[model samples]
Target: MLSIENSKKRVTIHDVAAAAGVSISTASKALNNTGRVGIETRERVKRVSVEIGFRPNALARGLLSKRSFTIGLLTNDTYGRFTLPLMAGVAEALVDHGVSVFLCAIEDDPAMGQIHVEAMLDKQVDGIIATGKRIDRSLPVDLSNLPVPVVYAFTEGRADSVSFRSDDGQGAKLAVEWLSRIGRRRIVHLTGPEAFFSVRERAAAYSAATAHKEPVLYGVWSESWGHEAVARIWSAPGEKPDALFCGNDQIARGAVDALREHGIKVPEEVSVVGFDNWEIVAAQTRPPLTTVDMELKELGRQAGLTVLALAEGRPVEPGVRKLPCRLVVRQSCGGQPSEK
Candidate 1:
């Protein structure tokens, strides 16, 4: 592993000049792409700098150029839970390109928009990335009018804002297909709290994927929601479902616990599948879980890159860029591929 401390030794224009056999000012122009330098020499200087592991001091360079070289991140509390990994992916990508990130979580009213925006502007952030999942209702309409370019992740901005969307519909279809492959026709759905676009897309996918057989849908994203859904299922007087598809692993875990209390056998009497391959919760369950991995980190990275492009005045695709989701099969869903 290359130690950052080892890599942090300053590599100045003088060093690049000495290495590239060019004058100091010529080295500066080539490395910063400022002033004017021959294209061939510029490329040679840049290549040699990379070879020697030269990293310019981001702050001093920004001061000279008058660009902050930083992006401000705004998100809800789950930013760490759902947004952090994506942020990590985004940060990794940005670091290579020499950008720094400033992050803050907004949990209250009048603060998400007014307060956070004021702070970022005060610091002169070059761009802004806001995570939309679990967004508090207080973000003002005028928040989009920030002086710098602003991007939203796991969330959308209003009016001419470019955003990235998760492929939940596709994820739902994959989940349903997995269940169908196991010969589980009567699949039930557990959903997240009402009216989220993600829940709606998943429901639509469920409807589409099971259109041939008409599977059932129910439940929300939380363990409590799963508990309530199971109680309802237990109380209803009808033929029991063969499988339960949950909105996320949290609900599936809760449902699994409740099923045991009701003497139901998982993957035997009932099979279960869920969304979001939440490892901590997914890995620790009694029978483990078969769930869809939405690749939130990739999603965040995509959103970050998109926003950076827009900020840089580069053209980006107008419609949503859907991130990929993978299905992770485990013991909870009977370990049997659906055939119907």
Candidate 2:
């Protein structure tokens, strides 16, 4: 069914052979890095192949290796806020390894999760990376007994599975430290509901860093809550805070708006730092925002590599692994823009 034009456009091993000034068998051996060949000649052949944009047939390569060269990413993050960057990291990590990904959006549906799992199994995916919107919660379906290797990223899983997450406490500490370094004292912590484990971890870190005298404020993860918290904190004006550490960007943005209404200048009057350096929210703030980034993409890259290692019969220690978070500096906290 291949058209003549398409057939002509396809680059074959013969083309590599011709370009590399080698026989077809020699080209194949050089390309696969198998059989005896001169080192210089092999390098030349590879360079030429790359220059010509030659790509081997993946189906044929998979057939020889008995690996479908595919992976499955199962997530309950329907909004893709967490999953999108994670998926990009996974795909980028595996592209050179000749593996593709199948994304399954389960969206808190047990039946849907089961269906996707079964489908990935049917396709013989080498492994699966289970991720979600939050690290505190697990996906609806069971992954403990799956046939393939499973790695958890930004989500809870079985106790013994290899997992990756951002160091929430450390990230919070970073934010607090940044505020202190900028000579802002009287810091106050405003965060989400107490039910989430991250909220507690962040609050504890904030307390340790500041020996926080003021009580921690817990509310819904929303801009409205941020606005309300600001109002309450300013109501009793006995020595107001010079800095506000928000749990997320939404709350920070709301706090900034409320501060504006109160005629308080940002950074100059009260430096504001937020978590989850969500670009859309943080970068668009009046002076931009200084926030902590969980590095979810890097977590995904590590998770991808770990799952692939397991699939390739390599041993990896199983337990929860906490990756580091980074502080992205912007104008909100009187910091220069991040170079990276």
Q: Which candidate number would show the highest lDDT if scored against the true structure? A: 2
Residues 160-278, candidate 2: write the lDDT tens digits. 88999999999999999999988988899999998999999999999999986767899989999989999998897589999999999999999998998898999899999999999
Shift in Å, residue 333, candidate 1? 0.8
lDDT value for model 2: 0.91
**Per-candidate clash tally:** 13, 0
Candidate 2 TM-score, true structure as reference: 0.86
Write down the TM-score for model 1: 0.79
lDDT of 1 at 138: 20
The 0-to-1 C-alpha lDDT of every candidate, in the order given, reads 0.77, 0.91
How much is 34 displaced in model 1, in angstroms?
Answer: 7.6
Measured by C-alpha RMSD in angstroms, how accurate is candidate 2? 3.9
